[model samples]
Target chain A: MQTELSGQLGIERAVFGFTPFPAVAAAISRAGGFGVLGAVRYTAPDDLRRDLDWLDAHTGGRPYGLDVVMPAKKVEGVSEADVEAMIPEGHRRFVRDTLAAHGVPELADGEASGWRITGWMEQVARTQLDVALDYPIRLLANALGSPPADVVARAHDRDVLVAALAGSARHARKHQEAGIDIVVAQGYEAGGHTGEIATMVLTPEIVDAVDPLPVLAAGGIGSGRQVAAALTLGAQGVWLGSLWLTTTEADLHSSALTRKLLAAGSGDTVRSRALTGKPARQLRTAWTDAWDDPAGPGTLPMPLQGLLVAEALSRIQKYEAEPLLGTPVGQIVGRMTAERGVQEVLDDLTRGFEEAVDRINRIAGRSGPS
Target chain B: MQTELSGQLGIERAVFGFTPFPAVAAAISRAGGFGVLGAVRYTAPDDLRRDLDWLDAHTGGRPYGLDVVMPAKKVEGVSEADVEAMIPEGHRRFVRDTLAAHGVPELADGEASGWRITGWMEQVARTQLDVALDYPIRLLANALGSPPADVVARAHDRDVLVAALAGSARHARKHQEAGIDIVVAQGYEAGGHTGEIATMVLTPEIVDAVDPLPVLAAGGIGSGRQVAAALTLGAQGVWLGSLWLTTTEADLHSSALTRKLLAAGSGDTVRSRALTGKPARQLRTAWTDAWDDPAGPGTLPMPLQGLLVAEALSRIQKYEAEPLLGTPVGQIVGRMTAERGVQEVLDDLTRGFEEAVDRINRIAGRSGPS
Candidate 1:
C-alpha cells in the first residue's frame, strides 16, 4: 500500500522490502519513508554495481537511495603512492604479528594478501555513487562527512537529493552550505562514528542552529517514542542503524554474538574507538578493552585504521567465534531482544508513536486554558 | 588543633561540606580536609546548635563534619496522618490551585507561612545531630533514608566519628548494620531530591555492593582526578555535594536564583523523588517548564510534590526574590565554575587525618589489600 511517505518518494512498500535485507530502506519506503543502502563495505566496483542493480530491479520502479563514506579528513589525503610508501615495514610487521598472536592465519598463497592504504579508496566510493546514479536512485548520502563537491554537483545534476551526516550543529551548517538537502544529526549514542553530544540536547540545538533546514535525528533511537521525541524536538524523521542489526533479514552472521546482544542491557555498551578510529558505540568486549588500554598505541586515523584491521576483522567473521570482532553497532543494540521481520519493527514504531502521543496528551491535559 | 570525632572517635580528615555555607566548616577544619554542617537550614530542634557550638569550640581543634539530605527514595513510611497533619490547609490549596493553573506563587502571606519546607528543613536538619561526642569532628554525614538506627547511639555512645548521607546499596548495607563509620553514595546529581542512577554507573555499583564499607562517593563527581578516578571507582575517602553553589564566603547572601552551575561535560542528570517526592537536577530554566506544568497532578509524595512549586519554595525562603531554596548537593555541582579557599579545604582533611592516624591507623588503611 502506498503511504504519505511513498507519495513523497514515489516508492511502494512491497517492492522496497525485497531489496534491502535489513529491510530498513525497504520498510521506510514501504511505510512512506525513504530507505538508503549503505555502500561502505563493498570494495569492488562490480560488487557494489551488482547490489545496486539488485535493488533497482527489486524496487519495481520505486525510488531508493545509496550511502557512501567520504570522510572530510584523512591522513592528510596522502596520494595512493605516498600512503603506500608511508606504510613502514615495522607497522606492517606489527599488524601481522598481532593477528598471528591471536591465532589468525595469513591469507592463502597467491591471493592479494595485503590491501593498500589508498587502494580503491575514493575511486571505489565514487564508482558506487556513479553506479547508483546510473539507476533510478533518488538520493545520495555520505556518512562520515560531506560528499566531495564534485559528487554533490554530479548528484544534483541528476536531480538526486544530497544528504550528509553531521555530529554537531556546526557540521550541519556546513552540510547545508554545501548544498546538501538533508542533515543527519547523529548523536553520540548512535552506532557509528558519532560526536559527544546527546540526542536529547543535540536534536533541538541542531534544529534551532540550522533553522529551516530539514534534519533527521539518528542515534540511540530504537523505539517509536524515541522517534516521537525526536520529531517533537524538531527532527523531520529518524535515521535508525542499530535497530536493523538484529533483524532476521539483516546480513548478521554471528548467532552467538547476536544472542549476547539480545540479552544485554542499555548500560552494557560503551563508546570506544577500537573499530573505526572514531568514537562509535558498540558492545563492550576484550577487543575494545585492548584498544582502550592506556599503554597501547592509540588507533590510527580513519581509512588507515579501517585498512589495518579489515583483514583481521574478515578472519574474525569467518571464524564467527569472537565476540569482539564484529562491526560497530549503537547502544540500542541492547533493545534487540529478538530477530523479527522489518515490517514488524516498523509496526512497532508506529504503535510506539501513537502511544507516546497519547501519553504526552494525558500529561498535558489541564483544568484550564493554556 | 586535633579534636576527636566522637568520644573515642579520633577525628579523621574533615570531609563533610554540605552546608548553606560550606566555607565556614571548610575553614574550621583547614589543617585536616574540611567539615560539613549537616542540613544547615532545617528549623527543627537539634539543628545548628550542637554542630555550630562544637565547630566554634573546636576551631583550633581540627577539621569536622556536616551531614544533610541526599535521600534516594522520597517518602516511604510517611503515614496519612503525617502527610495530612504536616501540610497546612493553605499550602494544600496552593498546591491544588497551582496544579489547576500550572502556576505557583512565590510566597504566601502571614497565615499561610511557616516552615514550608526549604530553608526550614535545612534549619531543622542543621540541629538534630550532636556535633560533639568526644573525638574531634572529622566528617559530617546525612542519611537519606531513615538515619542509621544507631547514628546517635553509636556515634554519641562512642564519642567521636561524625556520620553522613547515604542513598542505596541497601543504604550502605544499613550503614554497615547500624555501626556505620562512614558511608555516603548520593546519586541523584546534586540539588534537592535525586536517584536516577548516573554517577558513571553509581560509583563501582555502590563500591562492590558495600564490601568493607567505609566508602564515600557522591553523585555527579565533577573533576579530572576527582578523588581521582581511583577513589570513586573504590576508595576509603571521597564525599562532595553542592560545592559548586556560591563559594566566595562573601556572596553567601547573594540571590540563590542567580547562582548557576558551570556547563558539565556529562549531562546525564535525572530528577527522581528521592528527597522531596519529585525529581530535581541543576539545569537552567528549562527545568521549570517541565516541573511547573499545571496539567500534571502537582508532584506527589513527601517533601517532594510540595517542593515542586516555585512559590511554595519562595514562601519558605521569604526572600523578596526567589532564593533558590534547596538542600544537599552532589559532586556534579562542582561545575559551578568559581574558586575560593582551596588551601583551607584541603588542609582540614589532611591535618584531621594525621591527628586521627596518630591515635588510630593501627587498624585504618591497614585492613589488607584494597
Candidate 2:
C-alpha cells in the first residue's frame, strides 16, 4: 500500500507523531511512510489499545510505529513506587505549593496519581508493546537507549523492525552490535535529548562507523541541500522531527505559540534539561530560564522530573497563554515559517533531494551514464 | 623573539620574531616559525624585494618564507602583454563606461600598468620566490593551490617545506598527490577563497581522507573550543588567518572597517565570488553587492574579473568613504571585538584550546587516565 516506505524504511520519509492522539498518527500514515505515537502519556493498557485500534480504522491499516522512552541507565533498579517514595516530602510540597501560587488548582481529592520511573514504568512500556504488536506496525523505535533484549526479540518475532536513536557514533555502534536495524544519528541541532556534537560533523562520522547498517540522518535538516549533503555523507534517509512539529496538521497549543516559532532563527534554540531532565533542544522560554537559574533547585532524573511538572505543563497547554509551553524543536524550526500539509512537506523534500542530487552530480562532472 | 610558531621552523624563540609588519618575516626566522609576508596587495616584484631586503637587514642572517597566489586554474596566463591583449577592447570600454556611469574617472595612462593577470604575474611570483630563496627561507607556501612542480622542486632543493591551501578533502588529495608537504583545509568561513563546506565538517573529513599528512584546520576558529574541536576531529594544529586580521599588530585600512568587523556576528559573513571571481567569504559590503546584483554586469573569471575592478577597488580603499570598500574577513570577526597584541591572541588560543580539551574529555568521561 505504501510503496515508498515498504522496501527500505530508511529511504522513506517518516513523520514522527509526537502526540498521543490517534487521528494525528493516522493522518501521518495516510500521508505516506510511518507515523509514531508517543506512548509515555497513555496510562492504562485499554487506553493505549483503544488509540491503536482508532489509528488502524482511520488509516485503513497503513503501517505506523510506536515510540517509548525506555532508558537503559538510571539511578538503579529502584521500582517506580520506590522512586516515588524516594522523592523528598519537601519536593512534593514544593510542587503543590508552586501550583497553588501559580493559580492552577490542585487535583481533587483521590484524583492525584503519583508518577515514577522504574520497573513499573518498564512493565507499562512492555504492556504497550504487547498491545501495539496486534496492529500492523512496520517499525518500533525507542527514544533513549537500546531496547531491552526481550523487547527486540518480541518485535523481531512479529517481523517488525526495531530502531534506536543515538547521539554519537559510539552509541550507534552499540545499537548495531545489539542487532538494531537502523541507527538514527541525532545531532545537537535536533530537539529532545541531544548531544553536544553538531550535525555536520556527527553525520559523516556515524555513517563511516556504522557501515553496512542503514542509517538515518536526524538533526537540523530543513532543506534539500542539507538532505543532499547528508546523503553525500552516506545517510540512507533523513529523519525529520521538528519540521513536522510546526506543520499545519500539528496540534500546537495556540496561534501565539506558532508565531513565536516562526519569529525564531536557528540560533534561538538551546539544549537544556529543564523540561526532560536530559539535554533536549527547545525554544528558549521563561520556564527554561527559571530552571536554568542558579538560585532554583536543580532538576531531577528523567521520569521523576517529568512527573513533577506534568500537571503544571497540562495547565500551561490548556491556557496557551504562556510562551514557555512549546516542546522540543530542532534548529530547523527557524526555516519553517508557513504551515503546510504533510503531503506538501513530503513533496518539498522530494524536490529538494532531486535538486541537491543534480547539484552534486554537476560538481562531480558526471552528467550522464559513465 | 617568537614563541608560538616554533615547531614549524627549526630556530629558537630568542632568535626569531613574530610581528604584524611584513618585516616580521625575517624576525620570525631569526626567532623561529619562519614568518612569511602576506602578499595580498603586492603587485610588483620591486615592492616585494624592497620589503624582503628591509626584513633581511632588520634580522641579520634570519631565514624567512614568501607566500604567493599560484591557483591551479586562473582566468588567463600571467604575461602582462598577453593578458592585456586578451582583454577584449569591448570589455575594457564597458568597464570604462560603467565607471563613468558611477561618476568615477578612468585611470591615468600609466596607472593601469600593474593591472591584469599575466604570465609575467607568475614571473613576479617566481621572482619573489627566487629572492626569498636567495636568502635562507625555510618554507614557501602557495596561498591558492599546489605550487607549480618546478617551484616545489626549487623550494625542496633549498630544503624548504612547500605547503598549499585546500578548500576540501578532494583538493587536499590533489595537493598530497602533487607531493605537497602540508594541506591546509580552509573552510567556507575563511576570509579568502573557500568552498561551501564549513570547518566543522571539512576538518575531520580532510584529516581522515589524507592519512599520514598533518592537517591544519582553518576557518571561523577564534577560540579554544573551536581549536579543541578541530584537534578532537583529528587536526594536528590550527592555521589561524582571520583572527590575525583584527589584531593590534594587523595593518588595517581604517578604524571604521575594524569597528564594523568587531560589531558583526558569526553569521554576518557571506561567501561570494564578488572579489576574485572565485567564492571568497567576506563582510558583505556594497562593492561585493554591486558585482552580486543580478542586474549588473556579471563577474568575469579569475584575474580577468579581478583585473576589471583593480583600479576601482584601489580607489575605494584609498577613499575609505565607500561602504563597498569593506575588506575580506571571516565569520570569526564577530568575536574579534577588542584590540589585543599578537601575543595576547596566541595566549587566548592556548587557553581556549585547553578549556575545550578539558570540556570534551569531561563529556567523554575520560578526563583522567583509564
Candidate 3:
C-alpha cells in the first residue's frame, strides 16, 4: 500500500490501533503494523515481564510499543494507603450498596480483586515503564500526559522513540516541547480519556504545531479510509484502539464484549466521568446511568474516582454482569460488529487503504464534484 | 485549484464552511464557493428578504443556498406560546440572576434578539423555510433533521436541491431514503448540535453507505489540510460553521468575536446544553459553567431551554459582555486567531489544498520516513 504511516513504521499499511493483549500485539506486528501493548492494567512486574517475553518469543523480532498511563498532573507523596484512607465512608457504602443491589456477591477472603494495581498513578506507571524497556520495544507511548524529560532521555538512550497522546494542538506542541518523538493527536471520539477536539481538525493542527515530529491520528480511526483521511490530515499514521476491542485476539471481559457487540449504534457511547474519573467515552450501561444520575454520588478526580470504582469493575467482571458491564470505546464501535483475527482485520485495512488511494487517484485531474 | 469539490460546485476550491452573514455568503460565492446563508436565526421574514436582496445585489449572479433548523425529532404540535409556558419559573429566575450578576443590561423594547427563531421545532423552522424558498436559493439544507417528504418533493419540483445533516451512517441512510440531495455528515466536534462520532470516522462511513449521493463533511473543518482530509474520507466537500465566526465579512456579535479571537486553544470550548437545550459545542463561559454546575438548576429541553436563555443572550449582546457571550463553535476555534476577508481565507484554503496534494504526490512510491 502507498502510505506515509506504513513508511514511518517500516511496515506495510495495516490496521494500526492499540490492543492490550500480548498475543494480539505480537500478531499485529507480525501482520505488518505496530502493535502496542497497554501495560497500565498490569499490577505485577512479573506479569508484564512474562507478557513481553511471550511477545518477544512470538513476534520473531518484529517491532512493537508499550503504553503506560502517565498523567502530567501528578500527585506527589501520596501512598496507596493514604489514597485508600481518603475514600469516604459514604462513597464506599455507595459502591458496596450498588454492587449488592445488582446481586453481585462479595469476593471470598484472600481472593484478589483490588483495583489499586491498575498502575494509573505515576509511581505505579514508573515500574511498568521499567518492565516495558526490558523488551525489544521500538516505542514507549504515554497515554494522558507528556513523558518526563528524564524518561524521554532514558527512552532515547535505549534508541526507543517516545510518543504521547494530545487532545489539542497546544497539547501536541507541549508534547513536542517535552521531547516526545511522536504525538498521537487523539480526538473526542476516541476510547479512554479524550479531548473535545475531533480528529479531522485536531490531527492537522497537531501536524502543523509539531512539524518534523510525526503525528499518529487517534480517536475515531479504524477503517482503511480513516487511515487515508489521517494521512490527508498530515498525520504519519492512524491509531486504532476501540476497533480492536472486538478482535478475536482481544482480552475483553465476556459481559463487556457482549454489550459492545449488541450496541445499538455509535450513539451508544457517552463521555462519562464515571470511568477512571476522566471524561472517557464508553458504551452506556446501567452502571454508568447510576453514576451519572443526579441522585447518585458524583465522581471524584482522577485516581480517586478510579480508585473508588475499581471494586465495582472487579465485581462486574467477577460476577459477569451483563447490563452493568461497560468498556472504553470510540463511536466506531458500531462497525466492530463481528469478531475477526488480527491478520484478517489488518488485511482488510491494507486493502481498504489501497482502494481509498486508488479512489483519490481516479479524481486527480477532476476539478470538483459531479 | 485542482480539487473534486470545486469541480462539482463549478467553481475553484475556495471557501467551504458556513455562511452566517449575507456579506460572507456573497463573498464566498465570489471567491469560488457555494455559500449557504443560515436563516434559522432570522425572526422576521423581512429581515431574511433584506439579506437575500443584499446577496443578490452583491453576488453578481453567483449561486448561493439557504439553511434552516429542521430537526428530525419533532415536537408533534406546539405553538410558540405553548413553548413559552413550558419554561419553568426556576429556570427563568436562574437565567435572570446569572445575567444580572454578569452586569448584562436588558435589550430595548421590541428590538429583535431571536433565540426563539433558532429552535428545532418543525413549526418554527417551517416558517423560516417559507421565507427561504421565496428567494432564488439553489440549495436548502436542514440543520438537525430529515426534511419532511412533502418539503423534499416540493424542493425537487422547483429544482432546488434539499440537503440534511447526519451525525451517523444510519442518519445518512435515512437522509438518502428521504430523498435528500446532499448529506452533510456532521461530526461530534462540530459547532451547533452534533453527534458523538468524529468526522474522521463518520464521514467515510456515511459516504460508503450512501454512495453517489454527495456527502459534505462538517464539524471541525476549516483549514486546507482538513478539506483534503474530508475528501480523503470520501466526502464530496466540507461544510464548516465555526471557521466563519472570525472572518471579516461574518456578522459575529462583537463580544463573541473577541472571545473567539482570544481563545487559547481547542480545550477552551465545551459541549454544553445550557444555551439551546441541545448539546451544542460552544466557547466555555460563566453561563455554561452555571448551567453545568450541580448547585444550579439543570437545563430544560429544546424550545424551553432556548426560551429561558433568550433574554440572557440578548442582555449579553446588548452590554457587549465578553465573559458571558458564547457562540456555537467547534474545536477548530483555536486556529481562528485572526480575522481576514473571505477572499484571503479562500486563497489560503485553495493554496493549502494544492500544497497538501503536492505533499501526497511526493509520498507516492516513497519507501520509509526520512
Candidate 4:
C-alpha cells in the first residue's frame, strides 16, 4: 500500500526497528521500506559514526533512521561511585552467586566495573544524536522518551522527522507536546521495554489522542496480515523489531540464532526487568527465571540495572550459553521460522498487504473471503 | 461486510459472550450475529435452563450458544469438603482480613459454603452441558480446555458446532485434534482467564495451526476495525465480551456502571489470580493490588483459590463497593465512552468494517489514505 508515508519515506508498509543487523536495514531500505539502526548498544559516538559511514556506503540512495534510548529520568548529577552505591549489597551478591551457579566465569576485578550505562540518560544519548545527525539519516527516534526539544528542532533543521515510542495515549500526548513527529505505539507483547496495554487497544487510542501526528503500530506484529491490521487500526506503517532476528543478514550470535530458529514460540518469551531496569519482553531463559524468583536479588532501577547485568550477559554470550542467553524478542517469534533474506521478508510483507487488501475488497462487496 | 459467517449467522460481525444481560444476547442475535451466554455463574443445571428459556423466548427464533468452563486439570475425586479443607488457613485469613479492612461486611457464617466451585471440573460442567443441549443451541463452547470426544460427537450428532477457547497454537492443535468445530483464539488482553501472548500474535498462530477449523478472534477486540483486523488475520468472525458491559441493555449495578464509564481505560486492568485460581484479566482495584503484593499470602490453586476469594467478592458486589469491585473486562475499555443499545453498537461495527475495507481498497490501488 503506497500511502503518504511511503511517498515521504519511499517505502512500503514495513518499518524495521533495531533488527540487530545494519546490513538488513540497508537491504530493507533498498527494498522500499524504512530501516532504522538501533543505537542503544553503540556505546560511543564513534561507534555510531562508523556504522553510519558503512551504511551510507552500502545503501544506494535510500533513506534510513537511527534509534537510541533517552529516558526522561536518570541518576542526575551523580558520580559513577554514587550510582554504584545506590545498588543494594543483596542485589550484587545475588548477581554474583547466580552467574557463578550457571558456570559463568567471574570478570577480572576492574572489568565488571567497566563503563557505567548512560543509555537512557539525555547526556549520553545526545552524543549519539550528534553523530546520528551527521549522517544522511531520514529520521531519529528516541526509544525510551520524547526527543529533547532542542534536538528535535535540530533534526527538523535537517528535514529529519523525530519519532518517539509511546506505551499509552498519555505518553503519546506527551510526545506530541514535546514535538515528536511520529509515535510508535509499542505494546505489551513487544521486545525491549513495553507498556502493559496490548497493541490492538493502544494503537487506536494513541491514533485518536494525537490525530495529526502519524502513528506506527508495533509489538506482536510480524506478518503481512498484521501489517494490514495495523494499517486498518489507523497506523501510518508497521514498526517491527523481533521479526528480523532470524533473517539471513541478522548479526546474531551462533547460539542465539540456533535457539531462536529451533526453540522459540509465541509463549517462550517473558517480560522481565532482569535484563534492563524496566520490564522488557525477552526470551524466557534460566537467567530471567532466576531473576524473577523470590530468593534472587530484586532488580535495580534504570542505568544501575544495566550496569549490573550487561557484563554477565556479555560473558554468557561469549560462551554461547544457550540456556542462559536471553535476547529481546516479541510473541511474533512463533512466526519467524527461517533465515530468509531481508528482501524476501519485505516481499512477503508487501504481498500480504496486497492480498489482505484484496480480501477486504471482497468483504466490502458483501461476498467475503474471496 | 456480509460473508459466509454473516450469511450463516445472518448478522453483522460481532459475537457477544457473557454480556451479563440475557436481553443483550437476544438483542445481539436479533441484530443478526450469534450470541453466546456465559454459563460460568450458572452453577445449577436448572439455572442455566431457566436463563436459556428466557433467551429463547426473547430471541425470536435467532440462534445462540452457551459457554461453560471445563478445565483439563481439576482436583479429581475430591469431595467439596475436602476441596474446601485444602485452602490454606493463611489464604483464608488474607481474604477475610483484607476485605474487612476495606469495610466490607463478612458473609454470615456458613453462607460462604453455598456452592462449591466445580467450574473447572467435568461433573458440574456436564450438567450445564446437558441443559444446554436440550435447547435449540447453535454452538457449545468450552471456555477452558479441550471438549471431551463424547461431547464433540454428541454435538456433531445434533448438527451443532463444538468450539473450544485456545490461548496458544498448541492448545489450538489440541482442539483440532479433538475434532473441535471451531477454535476461539482468546489473547491475554481479553477479560477472564487468558494466556500471556497478545491477540495480534496469537490469532494468526491459532489460525494457521488449525487451518480447516474456523477461528473467532477474541480479546482486546471491540470495534469494527478490530473485527476487520481479526478477519484479515484469518478469523471467521470476532468474539467479544468486555464491550457489552457498558451497553444500555446491560444489567450491571449502578455503581459499577458509573466506575466503568468514568474510570476505566486501556491501562486500568490487570491480569491477576485474585478472582480465579488462574490469572484472569479484570478491572484493577485495591483488591487486586493487595493480592498481588508480596507481603500478602500468595494465591491458591483453582477451586481452592475461588473458594477463598469469591465469597468476599460477591459480598462486595452486593454492597456495590465501587472502588473495590472489579469486573472482567478487556483493554478496549478505553474506547467505550458511552452507554448505547446493542443494535447501535452492532451498527457501528458494521460501518467500521465497511470503512476499513474501503481504506484497504484504496491502499491496494496505491493511491492511499483517500
Please rank every candidate by TM-score, starting with the best.
Answer: 4, 3, 1, 2
Worst 10 residues of 3 chain B by lDDT: B361-370
Order candidates by lDDT, high to low. 4, 3, 2, 1
Query: Which TM-score value belongs to model 3?
Result: 0.92
lDDT of each: 0.54, 0.64, 0.78, 0.80
lDDT of 2 by residue, B217-315 (tens): 677566654554454445555666677666665666677777777886544566777666788888887667767776766677666766666666655
lDDT of 3 by residue, A1-370 (tens): 4455566567765345577888888888888888899888898899889999998888767789899987767678988778878878887888888887888888888887744535888888989888888877888999888988888998999999899999877788889889888888888888888877778778888888999888888887777777776777787777888887777887665845555554646778888998888799888888889888879877777778888888778778777877778888888886787788888988887666656655554444432222
lDDT tens digits, residue span A1-370, model 4: 7656767777655455555468888877887778898877766788778888988787778888989887655546876567677888888888778778878876666664332355656667878888888888988888887866788899999999899999999999999999888999999999888999998888888988999888899998888989998888888788898888887788776656456544688899999988877899998988899888887667777778887776777777766666788788888888887778888988899888777776666656643344
For each candidate, what's the DockQ? 0.02, 0.03, 0.57, 0.74
For residues B143-217, write the lDDT of model 3, one tens digit per residue: 877888888887888779888998888888988999988989888878888877888778877888899898888
Is 3 or 4 the stronger prediction by DockQ? 4
Candidate 2: stretches off by over 4 Å: A1-6, A9-21, A73-81, A89-120, A368-370, B1-370
What is the per-residue lDDT of model 1 for residues B123-221, given as tens digits with 9 covering 90 to 100? 234334443333345444665554445454655565545454555555556666666566666654445555533332344445556676555656543
Residue A242's lDDT in candidate 1: 77
Task: Write candidate 1's Cα lDDT for A241-307 as tens digits.
Answer: 7777777667666776777678865556777876766777787775667667756666666555666
Using DockQ as the yardstick, the better of models 2 and 4 is 4
Candidate 1: which stretches are off by over 4 Å?
Answer: A1-24, A72-81, A84-98, A110-120, A366-370, B1-370
Interface RMSD, all candidates in order, equals: 21.8, 15.1, 2.5, 1.3
What TM-score does chain B alone reach in each candidate, compared with the true chain B?
0.30, 0.83, 0.93, 0.93
Candidate topping DockQ? 4
